[model samples]
Target: MIRAEIVKLYKTVHTWIGVSCGLALFIAFYAGALTMFQEPIARWASPPAVGVEAVSLEDAPRLLELVAAAYPEAREEGITLHLRGHENEPARVTWVEDEPHEAGQPHGHVHWWATLKPDGSLMAKQEEPSDLAEFINDVHMRIGIPNPWGSYFMGVVSLLYGVTLIAGVIVLLPSLAKDFLELRIGKNLKRMWLDAHNVVGITALPFHLVIAVTATAWGFGVPLWSAQESVIFGGKQKIAMAHDLERWRAPPPTGEAGAMMPPSQLLQRLNAQVPDFEPKVMVFRNFGDKAAAAKFAGAERGYVGDTRFGGVILSAVTGTLIKDNRASRQDLDRRVGTVILALHTGEYGGITIIWAYFFLGFSGAWLFYSGNLLWIETRRKKARKEGEVEQSRSTRLLGSATVGICLGCVAGLSLTIVAAKWLHGRVADLDAWHAYIYYAVFLGSITWAFAWGAARSAVHLTWLCAAFTVAIPLTTLLAWAFPMLGMWAHGSAATVGVDIVAFIGALCFAWVATATAWRVKNGPADSVWSIRKAEGRTAARQSVAIAAE
Candidate 1:
């Protein structure tokens, strides 16, 4: 009965839907997995990770002055204060500066940052390590493509993924019971892998569904509202842009003389004025005037609490609360967005959540790998039996693609992070080096796949990639072994957070390395291979009725 249902679904929409979204899903999971360790990766990118000390409240005002001097025109653009620093964090006062320029040419723009000394004085030279993180984020967000192109591309792929999620669930809804928890190995190799795939799919159904929908929403958010709703927008992107928090322009100030309040005081005033709120960023809406409004935005990292000010607009000169949305909106909407963002990024539950996210993300990637293996396994003896000419070329290509693209991405990202750390200070154009490394690795991976047989390189490249990523945190640990490179233990939570995450990442990499070794040596001859269950005869039998429907 279960076999009949599986065959039926295969004859219907199941195969097509999965294959259609498979590529996009692969990219998203691969990059999103990297995003799981964003903060730690960020710390690793900060070369010679320096220890941080707590900034005294008394020192904020003086430090603000030094930062202001460094960025005199900060008033014209914006000045932001970062209240927290990690173990290897650089205390940089950072902001974006819109330079003056004529039409058709970009006015000069710089996302400026300056590292501060331990004594509360600003470092003479400026450094912007966060750019590396942002670049990785952009790649994840929009495939590192620019403007409408990248976004539009990502949006289309995400929509397809979302559709696959819905369609997949519908197809699987019927057999969700009998076939679940059934993993058969060796009766028929294809049957075994299909069962393993079904089991993994069913178990992670909730997570996979969430990723699809959230990625869709994130990718299509702007287009759905602005482009599609242009009639409502009166054909003006500016109005839509204003509604979107991401929109920014050099809004000129009235230039009238008025006593502007300091951010330190503003932060305190914000907490006092709005109970249960924390400020993420304190911004002067206008750089030059009395009516210059201050906007503070924040929310608990996970979807646990309200946004710091919940989109409040406040008087820059005085802490007059303007707009607050603490309790007015639908709870479901808030939770949905927050949870989606948190879960997709593994941020909803803090460290535990991050670790869990990393595990699933990798598993999701492996699911694809195994799925490909199953496909290839099916065609192998048949192709040889019928001769290559009679065999399907499509399956062969997908087989190559699955191995090549997936392993390629892993190699690319690993190389990119290493390049970020190694190339800093040595290169005149550090940011350019960052970009070059990522693209080179990505392109190189694809080329390698075509040149070398996909199957052979998949195993080799993954181990190499795993080693590269693991090296980052390991290098940091070794570098700090004796308080070398001006490193000393700082009794700060943020610093501790950095070190702890690195250790965890190292462990994860070790696990991957082991998995790689197992795959290479013993081989996943059957669909489901577990280190723990290697001894049993037909013991791998567990299936979800999910797909059997």
Candidate 2:
């Protein structure tokens, strides 16, 4: 059995660490949950375009040749042949070219998609794809703070989070059997909340542990690499990384031009060789040269890794497998790394695992949110004297912050998602507008929370969350009903699923708002969550009644 003092010490450790890191973790987990369906979200946000089906696999050769002949730079930069026909793929063939800028300065790339026009001539346009999903991912990684600093902050938070997890487990060890799954839902609100938090924390312990470790590693990846170079690799880390990258790199082009193999034949060759490999896209370099190579980026069946990271490369001229870096062929170190990444990302086991991780992510976020509430409740009980009419300023401030940051993140993300279709063609840079809308709403909600106090702002922001989230589906509905709006509603299952999930989320938020409103009006007036200032009035009335008696 654990010692009482030891348990108390660990409890203190857990509380402080959790309180310090809970808000950031809530944002990370919430945004990270959305990213599980990043592809579907990307497809949902993408506008109608010349689809992958516009040019058949059989006709891909002609399209490639036309693009190569028209834009010689594409040959050197590599061209992508879309295979999955996802809604996000602008066309059967697409490539990106670096925008003109002075050397050694920060620059952007211009996205280009090529298709065969009605007259069989090359048709290409420079149109940027919707980056709403990527922005959400960025928020997940950086929590809306710019990189380097954000990464360093999250790294420290994740490290402390891991310590909190350990402290929590130690604190719970003595009562492990007795309180394992017991969730007491009764008049004792703090007891109920603590029970629920413990239950969820213990149940999803493994998942949380994986997340903590992976997040820390990734958050400090740059620093870790530098440390490894100095300490472990003796300055050979870059050389090692470069060598590892060689498996994915394409061969240099020969000056002499040669006949190119058709994309269909190359795929057939791919299938015969790597039967389990599903290619999403084939990236071609040196298209017309004798030494041309095509790198396939996709998933290998039953593998636990990202599609973008591993695949085979083929000689475009002879349809021969040039390099195989599929999961099965990966070196032990790479395979282990891939599995860890897949575990963190929920990339394995397909859709079922994705949904599992989705719910788990929300549960994790709630665990942190409730943890903060428990801390506030604990402090309130300790600081309050018998007839104290008000909560401590610290508790009140923390309460407002908790509600503001969490609900603000929710409302901001929902509204920004709704903006994807609404502002697509209307804005010169829809991507930049996404960031603008999210930050504006997020910061505004925080300010509102501080100004109005926690009780009122919680209800208000919860309602805002519901409204914004519901708008996601409503926006899609409007697009479907009115084509003149220059918006589109895709009929694909993936895109439709995004709308369905958002609608359900909106309903959940609405229910929470209603419950929160009821609590604010009717719950204990002495608490920060109660908007009514009835505590002082009640105490004075009791004294008057006692004197008369």
Candidate 3:
């Protein structure tokens, strides 16, 4: 027979660890889910521009010559030639120039895109691309907290999360076979929620394990690297990393100008040499010099985990292969690391895997939310008797926090996404405003939840979530209907998919709000989630005041 004390011990460990890390994990998973569609969302938010077709591949050589002659910095910095005509790509050629700043201070970059005018002249303009996708990714990585601290904070949380996963399995082990898949929906609300939570937890355990390991590794990556350099690598880590980086770096420019190979001929050469490589963008360094190189960044056919760390470097003048770092050619250690990263990000298996990860992310978020609710319910049962009217302070406080943080994240993300279209050209720095708007709504919702009780605030914030999410599609509709409003709506499937998903999300939030409102009104009065408890407390206070008067 299983010992009662052992079960109790593991249950306590699981509960405490889960509660401490629940809020951060919720934010991470929800934002992470959205990041599965990061590129699509970026395309959806991007404004129409010069477009990739404006400068055809045949005329790219002329454009390169013009840019090299006009802007000497670009030749050294490298110029990116966009192949895919995604909405986010402003033109056929783009590059970044470092902004002027004091030597010791932090510097910024100015983004520039160039295209050929109707005449044969060079038309270049500096414009910032939408960073909404990157901002969502930041939230996923850091939970909206600033860097260094955020990384350290999440590193600790991820460690605790892995512990909780182990403790949870131990706690459920005695009855694992009997209760694993049996989700009983009945009058016992806590039992029902517990059953549902267990089902999801056990089903997605593998995915969670992968996430926990990868997240912990990445969260403390810098510190870990430092430790490894000192301890394991004997201070040779940086040198090794520099050597690895040389594969991606272009050769130094020779002063003598060379006869540059045409981009069309270079592409043919690439096809002949590396038949399976599909390059998304060709980055040219030292464009007009003898040592000019073209770096092709893209995926090779039938290989996973090759998007970020794979590609080939070719001589820009002669179209000769200079370097090959494709997945098949990577060292075993580097290849394993790349695969682990891809597994965490769901970069393999194409669109179907992307959707699977999206749902898994949501499931993970709900697991934490449900775990919080179960904790509150367990406390309520232990703390209260049949005659008790007030819930425990601990449970009440946790309830309020749970409702506040989770719903606040939802409402904040929705509102910030809506602002992408609504405040585009109207704001001086739309990127900064994205941060401002998200934090404002997120903090405001938490304050509202504390001022009102969890019972009332959950309903209000959920409705707010629905409204803001619905506004995403409505904003797009307005842009399409009335172009005079200075907004745009791209008809591409990727952009339209964003609107459709948001509309569905809005409906789900509305349904949740309705259900929560009903439970607050009709559920048990002694519980923290019941509005009648708050009402009874107010009535008792009024009676005491009247008696005193």
How many residue pairs in model 1 have overlapping backbones?
17
* TM-score per candidate, chains pooled: 0.76, 0.97, 0.96
The lDDT per prediction is 0.61, 0.92, 0.91
Worst 10 residues of 3 by lDDT: 380-389
lDDT of 3 by residue, 461-508 (tens): 999999999998899999999999888899999999999999999999
Candidate 3 stretches greater than 4 Å from native: 1-3, 536-549
Q: What global local distance difference test value does model 1 have?
A: 0.61
- TM-score attained by model 3: 0.96
Per-residue error at 75 for model 1, in Å?
Answer: 0.8
Prediction RMSDs, each to the true structure: 8.1, 1.7, 2.5
lDDT of 2 by residue, 1-549 (tens): 788999999999999899889999999999999999999999999999989999999989999999999998999999999998899999999999999999999999999999999889999999999999999999999998998999999999998999999999999888889998999988787898899899999999999999999999999989998999999999688898899888888888878898888999999999999899888899999899999999999899888985757889999999999899998988898899989888899988889999999999999999999999898877767656665666788888999999999999999999999999999888899999999999999999999999999999999999999999999999999999999998899999999999999999999999999999999999866678887755555776799799989
- Descending-TM-score candidate ranking: 2, 3, 1
lDDT of 1 by residue, 41-148 (tens): 675566544322344545654555566556667766666556555533454345667667787886757565555576656763344554667777777777667866
Which segments of candidate 1 are over 4 A away from where they belong?
Answer: 1-12, 48-55, 65-72, 87-89, 113-125, 144-147, 184-188, 220-223, 230-254, 260-264, 284-289, 292-294, 300-313, 325-349, 381-396, 481-549
Q: What is the descending lDDT order?
A: 2, 3, 1
